[model samples]
Target: MSTATAGFPLLTVTAALPAVGAVATAAVPAARRTAAKWLALLVSLGTLALAATVLLRFQPGGDRYQLTESHAWIADFGVRYELGVDGIGAALIGLTALLVPFVIGAAWHDADPAEGDAPTGRRWRPTQGFFALILAVEAMVVISFAATDVFLFYIFFEAMLIPMYFLIGGFGDRAHSAGEEEGAKQRSYAAVKFLLYNLAGGLIMLAAVVGLYVVTADQLGEGTFSLQAITEARASGELDMATGTERLLFLGFFFAFAVKAPLWPLHTWLPNAMGEATAPVAVLITAVVDKVGTFAMLRFCLGLFPGASGWATPVVIGLALVSILYGALLAVGQRDIKRLIAYASISHFGFIVLGIFAMTSQGQGGATLYMVFHGISTAALMLVAGFLISRRGSRLIADYGGVQKAAPVLAGTFLVGGLATLSLPGLAPFISEFLVLVGTFSRYPVAGIVATAGIILAALYVLLLYQRTMTGPLEKEEIKRLPDLRARELAVVAPLIAFLIFLGVFPKPLTDVVNPAVEHTLSDVRKTDPKPEHPVADKGWFDYTPGGDHE
Candidate 1:
């Protein structure tokens, strides 16, 4: 029985609804910008409800990919419109839906017109277009997560950069250290750099995709870009590749994902992009858009080339270690709050990549959870910071002080965000970070020991960011008059903070969903959790067998 056999086109509707909403929102009259905003918000909420339905209907004990929909498209080329969700894909889909509404609310006025802003020039901030582009990006990302066909995944994977590019370049941050003209130039540079980097990666991936087709044609007497088809062929010993060919294919796929993941050397564009873009868009970049990359690593790089995946782990893990330490060290030195957060995200992504390559169930499972929790936590922190930056019209740490005195609620929320970033025990990120480190230690102890340094650096940066910005004497007049978060703003942030606390205490719901997928992925890579030298029971330390005495 095929996992992707005939079913209700639920997954297609889930993704397509937002894409349709984007078009509707974009068509609203310019004077009706407010209406456009409400429509986008409502669409995102609807998308969320649909995503929740997918989650509820998903059976963890069922087939690996469930609620799948497959249709014939480009049949001659063996390309089909196939969409499916395993636990990981479903969880990520939920994360995207969960965050988009908050992003919409926080960005309610982020794209509104400003003084000196040209009504008809490059400097114009089209309110409807901004919201529309966001919906558009969400639609692409949702489909990217749900896509099971290799070619189908790649199409949306590269297509998403279009809306994102416009979002970064067109609707830039109003608060710039430089003059408006200079900021505009900087925004252009960031947008171009972002596009060029990913485009270059996408082209390479395209070549690899072509190469994959050739391999299939020669070995199987047909060409197919179906993931299930290819994986089944490999498992049955009907398809084989030379070591060098498999390694090349793995590198090609991994490179594109790493760039999207924006690992280390390729990561230079993120800070500039995040700094120049509005806060919500920055969240969209790291929290939503970037997950596609790491998720692809799990889906394509490993799923298609398990042998080469093992061959490449050493180097991949090495790069991940560099990203962790390097991003943290740079973040500590950053003066701009948005850029600081950007660098911190790069560090967190490093940990995620490390866990994925750690090739253990705990590491992979933790990486999956990290994706979910980090999105919630970063959104909590970044959206609050955006609100603060908007009020003060500054992104500099030196420009803030005594914020706690006037806006105690705002300061408290900021504190929660900061603590969550540092992976404090009671926050959602701690569990994921702990599992990553444990998984790294189990397979790569020396790397794990070094990765601990990143945690210390995280604490330093988070606390210092808080100490400098949230506390101190009321020196600046703006800081003195800072207003507390309003009801609308509270609506944006409160739920995110609650999620951090709730998930921090109880991560079982997510773990239960994520672990099975991690096991499936481990099978693809032929890896297992390391057994403890001295076990109290038959199970290994990482085992999550339901807790009860067995007779």
Candidate 2:
């Protein structure tokens, strides 16, 4: 049986609830900003609960794309409002939900106005506008992941920029600036640069989406732009594009995802954005927002244009390797804690890109799981670094030394998070990274070996950062006086640490769900790239099991 059967619209409602909350938050008065925060929190928490419910109800080893809901919004134009998620999408949505509440809570006490004789003319307002902007982001990100329709996905994909633009330019930190004007100007430039790059990429994708529609309709007799319909037509050999058209469409989508992934040479905007945005905001930008790129590459580039994907794999793999080495080398040279995290993200994304292009079940599955693991690990490190920056009033690593003596809890937590970043054994990242390497090696042995070097470099950066910040003697008087984590702060961070341990020691359950979805995706891709001479005809690793689904 096909896994395309429609289920309840649970995922759709979950995606839409945040937008509803955004509207509600906007309705509140300016003087009652606290109420807006509470409302946004409640809304985000509700979305988390709904996501958990979906996780509980999700059936493993079944057909892909469960919890689907579709309604034809424009029959004449072949547009439909469709929503669904397989295990891969569900895993990412779960990560987004988990991060939203934490990001919101972390920003709770960040409001202060520097209208007085403060050293830094910084003003923090946890305003209704800010909370509403965050809610809008959560809404769009969830929708983007949940959207199965190409059109709806693109809409949510582009919609994300508005909130992020405002969050960085309007609500970000400007304390270290030469003056408020300069600070605000820097923030504005980062926001606009981000928007322009992403918008240009989106326009390219828009052309591709239209091209896809035209090709399908021309080939398949008044074709509908439905994902399932398109696939079915292709399966029946009723629809196929010219090689040139296919390659063009593939690039239209590829360029957009690469920019979002901020792969190698296109990664210029990330450092500036990370440096200027507030830490909590930076967490979402790096953790959830940037994932759109990699995920889209998997969903669009591979799913729709498998032949082109095969042709482009080597070029993309080379670029991924470059990002890995380049990002890590740059990270080691960073003085700012936040920019270091940003650079590390670029390196991690390179690893993810490698997994995607590996073109094996294990490689792809490992890549998907890496998305979840890295999101958690990166958020933890960034939040901890944010707290450290908050207390020290500086993000420069030189400003920190011997914090372990004064802030043991912070030191301990930072150590754990940092180790997790480097994929220490018995940690969540280790299992995922190992799977990626093993899988990549099965297909591309040389690239896999080089990728392993990236892992060694990861260890270097992570450990060096920890030793420099948390281990040395408390030389500065301020370092000796640095306060440990308060109970509330620990409350926010402890659960993330617990999850790391839980996911690390016992990853099978998550893997079980993940592997099957990956198997199904690989199976589909093989249908497009059939190998008749292979022992398993038109089958990838998904059909490798003896006397099972393949028969």
Candidate 3:
């Protein structure tokens, strides 16, 4: 599931070029905002091209991690500037590159006052700055995805908050607050919640990362803090820990990812953030940013603590099921479309968690694919919802009616996205959801059956939202004059629609790349534990349905 092609520093160029654009955009003058936006767009496009090249050149069935690069960054602290992509990371990095430019394009017209309008004050400057911040965030997120060294990953992981903080607090929806001034305050509150929760979780993870380093160093005598090295040392039985210490380390990592995954109970911050943040910012958060949690869980938790992960599967599955039912019920009662989507995301994340903890190859592979699919689906849903908000100046579902009669393209696109969210057949969500369900059924049939009802609830909520907003008579004066998606708006949404269908009907290409990594990971977990017998075939990958057969 890795590529071993030379002559292409594809990963670095794709991850860092957008950062360069962010810096360059900051240097541009207010009068030349168009130039800054174009520069950012071009940089994003270049990165996308690089990602595509990586995809094209990748050897899908070869190594487990490919296009790998490593160097010493902070040797005194045992941190290396190491980066690589297994199938999961590569797919996510590609998703980031694809989505960021669309996010920029989504807000490009809004970044400054539209043509023929003169900005009156600091508004234009801050708006433009938000675009730059988004680009910077995209850069940091891509780096996080590519990072393999624990310390380097943590740095990028936490550093992502700054740009996003400003993006929401400075340039989010003004309608959410009591007034324009209160809008900023609301955003600030959400930002603080996001920062505090993530920071607290991160500090815990930092202790665990350090704890891991110490354990490796103490046990192996000359260990470095490379993910590969730590993993190898653990596999070889060089580093050992008591059960209690392993559990503590697991919680440290678990709390951080759970918060980001916004797993139930720990998910209070997400609704507030979605309620106040701009659509573009919300897209980044839901689609790209939140993936960091699951990504890290897959990379560190499952990779580093396989036995602990396996042992703790039931508790995790229980939480995931709770999130599934709870999030859906909450979504049904929500008046705000954005908040509704936020809750829906929590539900979907529960499914991902379920898949991961299923401890089956199909479940793991489906979880990985679901991350990418959800990113696209959620972005599409949020952006279209944003378009509705911008035109009508409200996010309340009651505020919209007969939008289909008024805006056919918006209605149609929203329906497509909504159907995808509900995991309608022939769409991208269906395939991944089926895989997760099928995978989980192999281990926890009862939980899987209960969780399947979430799909039905999702259908109901999405349909109800769509019918209330788009299909009814244009009830309000504001809804009467709403416009269909403009050319600029189409630019923002078209790619997401394309990808939703692309991944739906033709996911095999991606699954081929990912299966090898999933296989490798499962093999390592079973190797380290060697109990409860896993399905390890001579093909070197485990099949999900079979029980107690490690060949």
Candidate 4:
């Protein structure tokens, strides 16, 4: 079970296929640029196929990581090349695989020349480099999710930033108001801001990793960075440390994840990055890349320092509430569509964090599933927004009017995505959002009640956006001639919409895959709900049980 049991090294191949495609795409001759695009698509589809295989092979109710591969690397330092996936990781990896091809397709014509530009004149083309960077990012993300060695995970985690930096800096759409020089400056500024924020967090976590290695060495007479080894040692009470030391180490890791999760006050960089990045890059960043932070929070922060996590719960829950309220308010007021989506993500992430800190199996399970649902729903919104921007030649909400008259399909798609964002009934996000609230309520009723207000705010923002952009009179000539969603666009969004409905109606399968992992994580953290101080009698004025009879 530890090694790739099948004939193929599935996880390694799945991760490496993208990199191989990147190299092949880059090696293609400049004259055959179209071939490079096809190559990237083929590679992405191939990776998706491999990911499906992993999913099919995955054991649904298993508590252990399956299809695992491990080998000794840096033996002197006790580092090993280890990769494995629990149910949670398997689902997210499947999400990553599913999204990349569509992202590639969405960007296919993104680099075309503007209207009235001379055909012979210099114009941007979707070059091999753009797709290569994307594939590179895919490889890194897959590796990060599959990695079981803390050091190995850190390596892939930091390595992920390089391609993403270029993707944001070089491939972003220039702001229309800003001249080329200013737009380039803005993109560069956002890219650097994103890089600096993540790098700071990564460095802090690196210190924690080194400290953990040293502590493990002191306790066991040999250092190790294997997640399984460290977790087992800590659980068995073989690796002990001072309370302060444990808290400090936990904070070191928490700081990085919180920044990446972009929880409230630390979330300033996200709006700028999302606003400046192209739609495909935005989808990747918001949908897949950002999940890394929360994933690491569940995988490392709680798993490695359960006591510290429990001790920090009150403060973490406070932060989560602030993020939920603050992000919603900002999103409601946003005029820029992209920045608005960015803020919405911050709000959704707040819910995810709240569930994680709720420290119950139900809450963690909901949080994990929320990560997947959010990716699907958000990707749809961003891509559709990109289409709208392309048509209107603007990103300002004020610039749109009567879009439904011009492109009914586009408007309808946006509405579907917006509805999903609001967690409307019969959509994928609703189930997870409901579970998070219920789980939180079961533990901290006051926080859960206050957080419920966010749902109302969500409906307001989504409907308001819809009303402003899609429901007005068709007065503008530019809007009158705009095209509806075309074949390619339909191809891109159809699966996402289908999934939103599919998961909404039938979430049991996904929850089944997620529950065991959630239970495992909760057990590792040793968290349980606090019992009520005063239990009410079943036949009395207040009955907490589901079916209490009143006299």
Indicate which candidate wins on lDDT. Answer: 1
Error of 2 at 451 (Å): 0.9
The parts of candidate 3 lying over 4 Å away from their true place are: 1-8, 113-123, 527-551
For each candidate, give its TM-score against the true structure.
0.96, 0.92, 0.93, 0.95
Q: Which candidate has the highest TM-score of all?
A: 1
Q: Give residue 516's lDDT in candidate 3 (0 to 100).
A: 78
Q: What shift in Å separates residue 238 of candidate 1 from its native position after superposition?
A: 0.8
Please rank every candidate by lDDT, starting with the best: 1, 4, 3, 2
Better of 3 and 4 by TM-score: 4
Model 4 is weakest, by summed lDDT over 10 consecutive residues, at 542-551
Clashing pairs in 3: 402-472
lDDT tens digits by residue: candidate 4, 1-551: 54335556799999999999999988888777788889999999999999999888888755468888888899999999998898889889999999999999988866544454466464655488888999999999999999989999999989999999998988777544566668778889999999999999999999999998898899999999988888888889998877898899999999988988889888888998898888889999989999998999999888888889888988998899999989998999999999999999999999999999888777889899999999999999999999888777788898888999989999999999999999998999999999899878777778889899889999989999999989989998888999999899999998999999999999988887788888788888776544443555644443232211111
- Looking at candidate 3, the ten consecutive residues that score lowest on lDDT are 527-536
Q: Candidate 4: which stretches are off by over 4 Å? A: 1-7, 112-126, 529-551
> Which sections of candidate 2 miss by over 4 Å?
1-8, 111-126, 175-179, 527-551
Question: Residue-wise lDDT of candidate 2 within 200-296, one digit each (tens)?
Answer: 9899999999999889778876746666667666556677878899899889889999999989888889988988788889998999999888888
| Candidate 1 error regions (>4 Å) | 1-6, 116-124, 533-551
Give each model's whole-structure lDDT: 0.92, 0.82, 0.83, 0.88
Number of clashing pairs per prediction, in order: 0, 0, 1, 0
